[model samples]
Target: MAITDEFLPVPVPESLSATYLVPTARGSGAKPAEAVAALGERLSDPVGDLALQMIDSPLMTVDTRPVSQFPELPPDLLAAFGATPGQLEQLRTANELVVVQAGYRPGWPPVHEWSARAVAAAIAQSLDGDLIDVFSLQFLDPATALRSLPDNDGRLRLVDWILVPYSPTDTGLWFTTKGLRRFGLLELQAQEVPAQFTRAWGAIMTGAARRLLRIWTESLTEQDVPAFVQLPIETTVTGHDIAVAYGSPERHDSAGSAGLRLDLDPATDPDADSFLTLLPPAGQAAAPAEYFAQICTRLFGSGQPEIRYTRPSDAMARAVETARRSLRSARDRFLIGGLPPGVQLVVKYGLATDEGQEFVWASVTSWSNPGRIVATSTSDAASDPTVRVGTPVVVETADVVDWALLDGRGVIEGGWTQAVLDERL
Candidate 1:
């Protein structure tokens, strides 16, 4: 289905932004102006100079905000990002941050972000500095940042920009589209979502944020923008297309809602812009639980009501075996490189069920070995309604149906069964 938009009264994102933490020594680092000056020459069109000079925005600027004394790097960030000693030392001794911003190029795939990324990476490479995605909170060395794709492969980066943290203490799962604000939209939030659905919610909400960014970027006519706006976000549903209306989370006129409580925090909120949920369309007759379950089924291949392809062809079965055979290499890659930003590794498991064996995709957390991998399920049960989402699972090498390493944008390796299933299924 085509992506449609409704007009809204909101501030437009003035520019796309990023920060390069420059070391005090500046060791061979090209000056900020020199970096940006050369960035256009370094990149080709699509992700080129357009980042700095789009319509209705100011020219790309590289200004250094100085710090008198560098602070110690946070222990958690260093550990989580697996920062090397050199990187940690550089960050601790960093004296200034170079903030690069380009005019907003609001359109499909957000390619201009690559321009900002390339510019930052070039400067960091020249300066021997580090990169921090201010909006996404992802850390990139000059090498990784320099590997920007000129196409939709970059959309994978958006998944990080959304901070979807679910907490048991609060009985809430929260989402903050901290980066979408880069496009002039209010940072969004969703609270009170059940733990079982958090996994699905992560994908769903990020899709919402990207959808909003796309719509906001495309709909730029002169109007005060409506107090409330409605959008019909789309996604694939079991090979069919389906969508439900979403809007600013203003209070509902009625008490009953099968959808989420959509709250639109004004820019003047004395605090920050992290409030984030969705309600289905204004008036849909179906019950909330059943309605959304159908969507979950489509997106995740498992939900309350589901359709299962129980048998694999002989060729597909052989492909499945092929995936199992190659796990050692993928395991080795994980052991060496670790799962860095923009990389997702999922392993499909074949768990014995009363009906038969259920194949489920689990987000791999660690690779102790091909046989001792730990992961969390990405969906509810496929054929079995009793299975739950967000289940902690220990994936044994014997039962693995496939292993896929999705690395930043459109690159992926392994998943032999998946490669053939797309054609043979």
Candidate 2:
């Protein structure tokens, strides 16, 4: 997305208030005086410009500075720092700026403690805001980061919103009304692009900040909490005699073993009368009844869940046929498995196309002994010319159960089948 188009200017509210927290620390090789002097030099010009832009009013100069030698600072600085409410109102009416800075001893119980407390206090006092004490030594602790003031009757007051800086070092932001809550964090870094992209780059930064803020706030009310559960998939064949199998073991002794059976209706919803018409003609040649009996025995032997197939309703059957026809021409496919027997499927076909031709392909996968068939070749294969057969299509192992299935010719299909052979075999 184009960041320039995404981030347009919005009106700045009249009562725009933000607190700036700056930390000062003595470096390993630097003296305190030297550090302070360096900071003074670095900030002098910017501070002067800020004061000019922010502080403009007529007021008293209460310089608590020693009256012994230097009575007070320059008149302008004194006026900027000591402006009164009436002066402030007059300045505001005239659209003039005003700001104040008060200095105090940078004392502390300990050096490190002092540094943190001083920074927090300065920022809080600067805005006349409250100080939130963070117990965790971590850089930014959300629990104690900042809390809004209590409302009228001493109830914890929640603000309409808050602006927060995104930190890459920690997990997103965290907060608490009843207790602590964590919000995800985001990081954005610009790459070295051409000069023409400067506006686009700035827009990207602006949008990123806005999005992060929204996500942080919305997380407080989100309902979709994370939980793990197994989801099931069903497979069936139509218009032809077919066999089905199940390979996985059952979770309980009473549970039937895994095996496949011919399913007339694969769908959960079936049209009763229309489905009967699609069934195989009575007495027609079909996989031996014994085949299904054996499947049941094997499934029950392992104490696996029994796989069931029922006739499908005419509506569902027709829908499946329509979908199959539509997908017949497309080949490339991708599949993703959930939980730990992480299974993945990828398929590519060999057929000539106007665009290009692809022949070689490879895939690596892992699955449980009785894992469900998540994908197939006919559905996934891509049409390309460099087709080859027996391209190590399926690789299965016993010890680790990690396998790979690859095919050059566009053709692959198998799901819920009996174990082909034992690991030793």
Candidate 3:
């Protein structure tokens, strides 16, 4: 895509016509001489001098009439014959030209025709350019403004220029122009025509180039397809909860177990062909297993689960021994649970401010039984006393075991049975 495609060009009309009225000379009688003097000042230059001499020669001022007709003059020559609203305003504001009230037919063409010639003469005297390479003059409608039209000469063209006149009252007149084309007018128009024609034509051209560059960049990006891989996993577990009571001879005599149900949806576990159907053919070269391994490594680790079991009686004996040793270590070190992995236990001691200052003691209390474990130093004892007592631990055994021990009040202070925590411990 090109920037040119995004914006349209400005339209130029084939033919245009308008009128202007010449102001009468003031009674002070210095108007003509002053105009001639201003012309002389500019005539010091060769082109301006030639234009002035032509204007002053007898052939030029033939009728000095307020209205006259001239035939088929080149458009550029119009600048030499008349002044635009911009030029007149400059002169008027600067006091170089005076405005005198004049009468005209509401739709008279002759008045405008004569005014155009006068405008050309003024511009010729003021500008340094040759008369063949300047703008044409025209009257704006509503009869309150003036406009400039550039000639066909590539050298004199003005690009993207528009002038609009604003007058709140009929007594005053104003005019503005889009300015001269420093760059080629047609070249600029070929670019983007500005939303507001009064902007510099060169700026519009730069904007068009930038837009084209962006379009080309985006098109290239869209053509280059991206690649991806797919790996799927589907798993489910179902089970019913049951309550198991201990201290029952029969229950204690047999291993405990639970019931579970499972249903795996086939749609969720589609094979390679089904998976490939959703991906681009270009991405199918890799083996499904290779993609699956990648997905596993990305999601879960490469390590496989290891399962082992000891006889129920032996497992129970081992657990009791481990708990007893842990309790003894806690008393000997005044530290809790052999500093269980990732568990931070901090103890700070200071002298008591009052009577019981001789003794320093610490203890690990369990919720399963408020007194399940206790350790303390008695004043007369040579060492701390330690005790390990058991209470019913709420053990949830399934694919995993979640064990929680609570006090009579049913509040859990702390407990850990997660597989990760067990491994560390």
Candidate 4:
């Protein structure tokens, strides 16, 4: 779909706050200080597809590689840009650009006018390099990304969301969230674009930062967010309360409220702390108590103990954070991640009866779901975690297996772990 006015940077009303972003770049050999100088030059003439009234400080780093590093970039993709591989490669290495950020003013032009292609071309021309398509990072807008997720039928499964951490060294797009990297939903960079496609380059760049902010907020507010379990209590506050405070105007709670402010929540209360200063996920009104009970049971075991919200023990907090980060790290592995085949789905399920209740971690081998998955056990302890019961059981989202304890050695082992389940019990 083409990026229209809906995709453009929203006009900032004086009463409300808004910031505009543009991906700025400089040649590889150019000094980092030159980006700052170029910012001044752009402001002086204001001559480009995007005319700037105000600009913020650039996020300068020498770590970024150019678009040429993209793996297996097909010949057709290159031809569409009216460039050759060798030509593009020369330009890519020559122009190691710094993505400059800026605070846009009121009535800034819609981003389509200053497309990614245009910005990349302008930067290349200035650096005396070939004009080729340049790729940058962008977070999938939640409103757009969330629509792609299928509605769940009371079973936890993979949700389509992209939580990216910008890394200058990496050229591949990553979905830094739960589930394995192969199941990642937002691999926009890898998609095969049609030859005739006219990319809405400027619009995507303009909306990227805003979308990123939204994704971070959505990740934080996700019900049963595993990250909250790991936050370290800080004597002083440092980060923004991205949760609750993010979203379109309709999603906002109030304009000026103490609870709504960015810094106050975590500053005053340790329970509200997010490692990055984000607010813990607010309780979801739509989520049924049964679901919450299930999640609590899965994390801490049966009886569904009330997890203390305020001043949780350090172990509890750390576990939550570890779970959240491990999920994100699994996403980061996308550079080498995918479900190659023969991967088993391990799940922990609760069986309750009048006598009492017990939880068992089981494995489903060669699992498939046409409508619903039928389960069978291979009974191999090494290939799968050993289960006590002989009967097979079905579960949703094979990738939802606990990852909280999958750190250090877990990364080296290169697979999912029931470690969280093992530790919680």
Q: Which candidate leads in lDDT?
A: 1
lDDT of 4 by residue, 1-425 (tens): 23332221111122112121111245344332333245343322323213222221332112345544434344454544344556545533442432322222222221221222223333333454443222312222212222322222211112222222211112111111211112111121111111001021111211232333333333333333222211112111111211121223344222212110011122256543211221212442312222222222222234311111122346644654554445444333422434222122333333443444333333333233422333332121222343212234454433232321111112223222233334555
lDDT at residue 331 of model 1 (Cα atoms) = 78
Tens digits of per-residue lDDT for model 2, 147-260: 222222322211112221211111111111111111222222322111111222222233233333343334323234222111111212211111110111132232332222
- How many pairs of residues collide in each model? 15, 31, 11, 13
How would you encode candidate 1's per-residue C-alpha lDDT over 126-208 as one tens digit per residue?
A: 77567766545456786666544343222234543445443321222334455665555666665433333545555566656
Instruction: Please name the candidate that would achieve the greatest TM-score relative to the true structure.
Output: 1
Error of 3 at 185 (Å): 10
Deviating ranges (above 4 Å) for candidate 3: 1-21, 25-34, 38-44, 56-63, 66-425
In candidate 3, clashing pairs total 11
Q: Return the candidate ranking by TM-score, descending.
A: 1, 4, 3, 2
Q: What TM-scores do the predictions have?
A: 0.51, 0.18, 0.19, 0.23
Model 4: how far residue 128 lies from native, Å: 13
What alpha-carbon RMSD in Å does predicted model 2 have with respect to the real structure? 28.5
Candidate 1 Cα misplacement greater than 4 A, ranges: 1-20, 24-29, 32-42, 51-58, 63-66, 69-86, 99-115, 148-157, 160-163, 169-172, 221-268, 274-276, 282-294, 303-425
**By lDDT: ranked, best first:** 1, 4, 3, 2
Candidate 2 ranges beyond 4 A from true positions: 1-9, 21-38, 48-425
Candidate 4 lDDT (Cα, whole model)?
0.27
- Better structure of 2 and 4 per lDDT: 4
